[model samples]
Target: MCLYFLDCWLRTERYYELDDGDLALFESKREAFLKKYEKEIKAYRTERLIGSGTLRDYNFSSLPENILKNLDSYPPFNGYVYQNGILCARIKIEDKYFYLPPIYDEDCR
Candidate 1:
């Protein structure tokens, strides 16, 4: 199974920072992760992006405290980089689930 790193953006609290180490970690294993989860990621991302409309998706609780230390707010932000495109993870103040990106212009109805 491909391990996907979920960068969570909390709505009530800030909890993490995307730094060089994190970037390096993802970069190091990006190829392997992509090779294993390429198809799955692509398919899932397609649906999520469409479902979100114009809102961004996010995960609030998936972030570690260490990463959140740098933030000044309650909720945080997250990110996802796949073979298809870069996705930004966003969360609302009272929301639980992350809102995925909206569909591309061409994909809109």
Candidate 2:
């Protein structure tokens, strides 16, 4: 059972590959990405809380102080890293890791 579970886990797709230098570029623009998606992040969290019956109010302003603080610190995506021999940015949600697209500067294009 352990081996089967390990095999399934190993076979699961996790990382999204980035081009050379893309990881650094993504890191540099991380703040911008977070800011751009701030509304979406809040909506996602609100939906989660509502689904779990943890939040009775729909207004983001009404969220508990601790949850708000945690949301501020967490910022949806955790960080960028190399995993399974691939370079990618990791967005952690509910303990699951998902891919984050690179953020490019308009002038750099």
Candidate 3:
């Protein structure tokens, strides 16, 4: 699996800084949400957030305080590696989960 350390732009109000335990909880919830509405979430993201509609070079540190720092402990992130991977963001709408780069690896997580 390929892991890219990216500048991720997470929604503050939606997803706050999650510690180790909280991160696990969030991932479990996210997995369940995906199993149910993955297709719908994919459709929304493909139409609105990726490809032609995507936002590149987005400032990922727009979150408040050390939120970003805490989120870095999540999967597929190993701190910033000077890799300019375009915007990585995760948000949920109407009880549906959506993300730009879907399916992250937890190998070295």
Tens digits of per-residue lDDT for model 3, 1-109: 0112223563211111224654565477877645543433433222122221222322334544444566543323222221234334454333433343322223312
TM-score of predicted model 3?
0.18
Quantify all predictions' global Cα lDDT against the true fold: 0.39, 0.36, 0.33
Winner by TM-score between candidate 3 and candidate 1: 1
Worst 10 residues of 1 by lDDT: 47-56
Please report how far candidate 3 places residue 37 from its true position, in Å.
40
Q: lDDT value for candidate 3? A: 0.33
Question: Model 1, residue 46: what's the lDDT?
Answer: 31
**Candidate 1, residues 1-109: lDDT per residue as tens digits?**
2223344543221112234654665679887645544444543433323232123233333545654465356453334333234354554333443433333333422
Backbone clash total for model 3 is: 0
TM-score per candidate:
0.20, 0.24, 0.18
lDDT by residue (1-109, candidate 2, tens digit) is 0001122334311222344454565578877645643433333321112111111111233334655566643335455555444333555546655543333223323
Highest lDDT, which number?
A: 1
Q: Candidate 1: where are CA atoms >4 Å away?
A: 1-56, 73-80, 83-109
Candidate 2 at 79: error in angstroms? 6.7
